[model samples]
Target: MSTQLSEDEIIQKISGNDLTIGSCASQALTYIGNKCGYDVRDFRGADSRWLFGQYTTSQKIAEAGGFVECDYNGFKIADRLLRNVEEGKEYFYTSGEHAAIIRKTGKKFEYLETQSKHIDENGFHPLTVNVLKKRFRTTKTRKLEGEKFLQKEVLIETSKISDSPNFKELLGYLNTDPKNQKREVPK
Candidate 1:
């Protein structure tokens, strides 16, 4: 049985541990995938199958592996794409270097800083996305040979929204296309 975690439930589950270094992506994936009702099992993904390659439960992150099951991937957006983020939802985005969770609540964007060592009992430090974009800003913009430059690769665990009545509309709203800005794909 899959149980979706409420915001408070997620916070409570993660309050017991301190996030590790270089574990941002793992931590986010663990948080999203741990709610899938599987516990204490070895990961069967395409990754290496070692003794330590196990699917951690709850806020307990693997620190190295991103083993979550996602539906859509292999696309990126321009730097200006951040302006189009939808509200009242959480997103996991990465620039091929660092990763974090960006949540929009009531016209505000908050990101969970999992890379900070000072997170203490919270296991995360929630900050404004403006701070995140500034802190994680790259020295040079990642542009392709012509005009379509891929800035940051993005991913969304569509399994979380497969049952939505407006699934198709939601996917359309998340289009990262710069010009005309519409990509036909599963969300």
Candidate 2:
């Protein structure tokens, strides 16, 4: 077995295309998930909670999702899973008038005044609440004592990939059927 690499180095290697879905990719993804205050098992829907993070601002959510800026923002989606890490307080998305604020350790809240893109019975847009729960799902006083929180990091890699024509080709190559292609890489 190879010695484990640091989280930042793993992320850098993954972003640089030196990593694939092999052990390197798995470890990198795990580290990335953890750094974003998410458990890989939960984000991957392996856990019973099946939660992802939630954030009000596109920026914060984008940051949490390793900055890929996909339709599913990481912060808001992970809220439900991490809601109990700090205290009973959790970030909630609603149709309100605020941009962004640090609601907890590394968690943030962003309120938008825009109309509900996703309407619910209460008249507010549908919200994802994973981070809040995963990181803070308890009113229990025990988990609240001296917990460590990570500041969220922004990932600009997606924008870089989208802007580069070569990226599409690279992604295509990476996503191609391995069975059809040669499987010469490490097992």
Candidate 3:
């Protein structure tokens, strides 16, 4: 069963962990992101899996061996975070007012988890959209070339909004055509 923790409790737990500055956190931390109102569903999507393979050869090798099931067992948020590490994208968290600090690298990134500062901004937020664009272009963008591209390519991140968040919004933005994004097919 899922255990719900208060924001303070969550923060305390995070502080207590030995998490590196930019590496993905244990599942406990992802649960905190959910409780704090951030949407991390994208980390759990097909696109993430594909890009991770592109970025982390180890993960690609793992996928070939059927290790991908570790990501599909629910607790998607945490699974996605670890996958992101394998994919070369770093993981981070921040105070709402500060920049996100990489958990493993100790580098501070420019993205924030909240939208409060982005409302007046005209461009896509780097924290949310840039990495996705990089992922799409590097791994999934060739499909625009022709049907042949689609046939050989790994599936993209496309999923519908069900009763829960599952990375659809992030993928919709990253995909070339927003309307083309599809609900995640059950594995």
Query: In lDDT terms, which candidate is top?
Result: 1
- Model 1 segments more than 4 A misplaced: 1-6, 15-20, 35-79, 115-130, 133-137, 142-151, 155-187
Instruction: State residue 98's C-alpha deviation in candidate 1, in Å.
Output: 1.4
Residue range 97-168, candidate 1, lDDT tens digits: 455566556666566643332334333344444454564443234435754343434434324433335433
TM-score of 3: 0.20
lDDT of 3 by residue, 1-187 (tens): 1356664443332222111222121222233344444432222223433442232422332232212322221223223433433222323321111212222223322332221122233112344334433322223223344532321111111111111253334223222222232322121
lDDT scores for all predictions? 0.38, 0.27, 0.28
Where's the lowest-lDDT run of ten residues in candidate 3?
153-162
Q: Which runs in model 2 stand beyond 4 Å of their true positions?
A: 1-127, 131-149, 155-160, 169-173, 178-187
Give the best candidate by TM-score: 1
Local distance difference test, candidate 3: 0.28
RMSD (CA, Å), each prediction: 14.5, 17.6, 18.2
If both were scored by lDDT, which would come out higher, candidate 1 or candidate 2?
1
Q: In model 3, how large is the Cα lDDT of residue 5?
A: 62
Evaluated at residue 78, the lDDT of candidate 3 is 27
Query: Tens-digit lDDT track for model 2 on 1-187?
Result: 2345554333332221112111222222233333334323111112211112223222433333223222133344234323422432222221111121122433443221111122221111222344233322312222226763333323322233234444233222232232332122221
